[model samples]
Target: MRILFFDTKTYDKESFEKQTGNYPAIEIDYLKTDLTPKTATLAKGYDAVCAFVSSDVGSDTMDALHEAGVKLVLMRCAGFNNVDLEKAAAYGIKVMRVPGYSPEAVAEHAMALALTANRRIHKAYVKVRENDFSLGGLMGMNFYQKTAGIVGTGKIGAAMAKICRGFGMKVIAYDVYQNPELADFVEYVTLDELLASSDLISLHCPLMDNTYHLINRETIAKMKDGVILVNTSRGGLVKTDDLIEGIRARKFFGVGLDVYEEETKNVFEDRSDEILEHSTTARLLSFPNVMITSHQGFFTEEALAAICKTTLDNAVAFEKGERNGNEVEERQ
Candidate 1:
């Protein structure tokens, strides 16, 4: 099986190449360019094209891939919101993804961000580096006995709940379907209650029609004063403009985001030399309370190895005409 891997980075190449030896029949060609309508023709001779979360796989790209004789679209990441699922189905392209590639890696990163932002660790580190060890504006609230509201109780949210429990926090969650395993300790609450009560709120839900901009103006208004907001999930979940307004109103003590709506053009790319004029991300960076990472919650070594193994396994299954339970289809 021949696979054209798009958006190839140094880390992605190193991880995938190390795991390719296990699947001898798979031949992969790496391309640094992202998968788009114009780049779809590059997959003419390959059976499938591997893509990341930032790749554009809309209707036009699907049409081009169909014309290029590509039958499969393998997403190396968990989120498939970027791909047009209905168009892929119409084009007879099977889409598969790595859904649960290391939930703990992301959950740990979320807690790390919360701690860093709340304690002003990033600022303190820079201050100490300049030989100035003053301890002003570094006060942080204790997490003990505070309420931690998890927006979703999926694998990653569940892991985050456990971490908060270890910190002696009261864990509350809001999900349509509650996990039975967490019923013993987690309190299932309504969205309003969670927003009004939680001292710290973490979002771990997928981006869908109903969940789009879930954390907007109204929701932010419901949150407790001096609340800490963290999002390690999809960027569209929070409305950036509304968030900025809430920040200006002094609604948040600190905000930590590993993903944001404007991250598509900047993810995994170095833009230090370029001026990001008219960028919402640049505007968000001007605030001292906001800390944004480059969507790197799943960049750990364990997560990378697991992602590589599952992606190649999915490709091998497709070649053999077997379903591996990772296939994604459009919902009716």
Candidate 2:
């Protein structure tokens, strides 16, 4: 099988190339360009096309891939919100994704962001570099006895809950389906209750219609004053404008974001010399209490290795024409 990988980076090529021995029959090619409608024809004669988080797999791209005789669409990441599933179904293309690839990596990054923001570690480092460490604005509260609200109870969210429990904090969660494994330690509550009571809120849910902009102005109003918020999930899960307003009103004590809405054209590229066109991102950066990462929550070594292996496994399963849990099918 021949697979063309889009939006290839140094780490992606390194990790995928390191695992070539696992799939000897497969020939993989990497391209630095993204998979858009104009670039979809580049996959001609390839058996499948591999994509990343920022690749555009819309209807036009799907049609182009179908015309190119590509049968499989393999996403190396967990979320599928970038792809149009109905269009893929109509084009007779099978979609597969690597879900739950080291959820601990993301959960751990979420904690890192929370800690860095709360303790102002980044600022302290800058201050100490100039020999001005007087500990004037570094008073951070303890996590013990604080209430942490988790937005999802999936593998990543559950992992975050465990970490919060270890810190001696009260853990409450809200999910459409309750995770029985976490029932003993986590108290499943309504979204309103979680929003009203949590001192710290972390989001780990998938991006869908119901979850798109889940944290908007209305929901932000419901949250407690000076609440710390962390988002390691999809960018669309939180409305950036509302978040900016919340920060302007002094609503959040600290905000850590691994993802943002307008990151597609900015995240993987080097635009440090140019001005950021997105005003919302610029405004968020202006706040001293906010910390934003370039969507590197799943950039750990273990997660990359697992993603490479699962992507190969998913491709192998698709080649066999076997039904697997990774396949995203059309709803009847």
Candidate 3:
């Protein structure tokens, strides 16, 4: 089978190329262009197309891909909010994703973000680079004995809870479906309780209609003053405008975001030379306590390799006419 990969980066190409040896029957091609309605016709000769988080797989793109003879859509990342699942199902196009490709990588990155933001590591690094290492604005609080709230108790959230526990933090979590294994240690509480009590909060939930803008002005008001917020989850989980307001009111001590609302425009690309037209994104960059990463929570070597392997495995499953749990279904 011929599989085309869209919205691919150098790291994606390197990882996917290295894993091609494991699936000898499949031929892979990398395309830096993102999958959109205009570019969907490029999948004409390929049996399947592999996409990433930012690729557009809406109704028009799905229709185009179906016309192009693309039978399968393999998403290398976990979130599929960008895809039009009902449209794909209607077109008889199978969609599969790497759902648990190194949850630890994301969990660890959340911890890194939390720690970096809390201690003002970025500012300290800049100061030291200029041989001026005075600890004036570098004061930070200890995580020990502090309350850490996890918004979701999925694989990634559970991993983050474990790390917070390791730091001697009082961990509380809120999830619709709580993990039984963590019940003994991580207390499952209501969203209001979690928000009210937590000194540090991390979001690890998926983006959906119900979860969109989970953190907004009202929710921010519920959180403790001077809270440290970390989001390694989907971008839409937090409302950027509300967050900006929160920052202006001095509601947060630090904010670390690996993903943001307008991420599709600039996350994976090198657009530093161009003028940033998005005012919110530009304003976000001006805050001293805010740190934004280029949606790289899952950029670890282990995660990239796993994503490639699972992507190939999904394609192999498609060739055999077999359905796996990774297949996405329209939400009822």
Best model number under TM-score: 1
Q: Per-residue lDDT for 1-332 in model 1, tens only?
A: 99999999999999999999999999999999999999999999899999999999998999999999999999999899999999999888999999999999999999998998899888898889999899887888999999999999999999999999999999999999999979888999999999999999999999999999999999999999999999999999999999999999999999999999999999999999998889999888888878899999998999999999999999999999999899999989
Off by over 4 Å in 2: none
- Tens-digit lDDT track of model 2 for 1-332: 99999999999999999998879989999999999999999999999999988999989999999999999999999988889899999889999999879999999999999998899888788889999969987878888999999999999999999999999999999999999989788999999999999999999999988999999999999999989999999999999999999999999999999999988887778878988775577788888889999999999999999999999999999988787798877667
TM-scores of the candidates in the order shown: 0.99, 0.98, 0.98
What C-alpha lDDT, on a 0 to 100 scale, does residue 229 get in candidate 1? Answer: 98
TM-score of 1: 0.99
Q: Write the per-residue lDDT of candidate 3 for residues 22-136, one digit (tens) a residue.
A: 8999998888899999999999999999888998999999999999999899998899999999999898899999989998999999999999889989889999999997999
Off by over 4 Å in 1: none
RMSD per model, one decimal:
0.8, 1.0, 0.9
lDDT of each: 0.95, 0.93, 0.93
Q: Specify the poorest-scoring 10-residue window by lDDT in model 3.
A: 276-285
The superposed Cα distance between candidate 1 and the true structure at residue 20, in angstroms, equals 0.9
Show how many residue pairs clash in every candidate, following the order shown.
Answer: 0, 0, 0
- Model 2, position 205, has a per-residue lDDT of 97
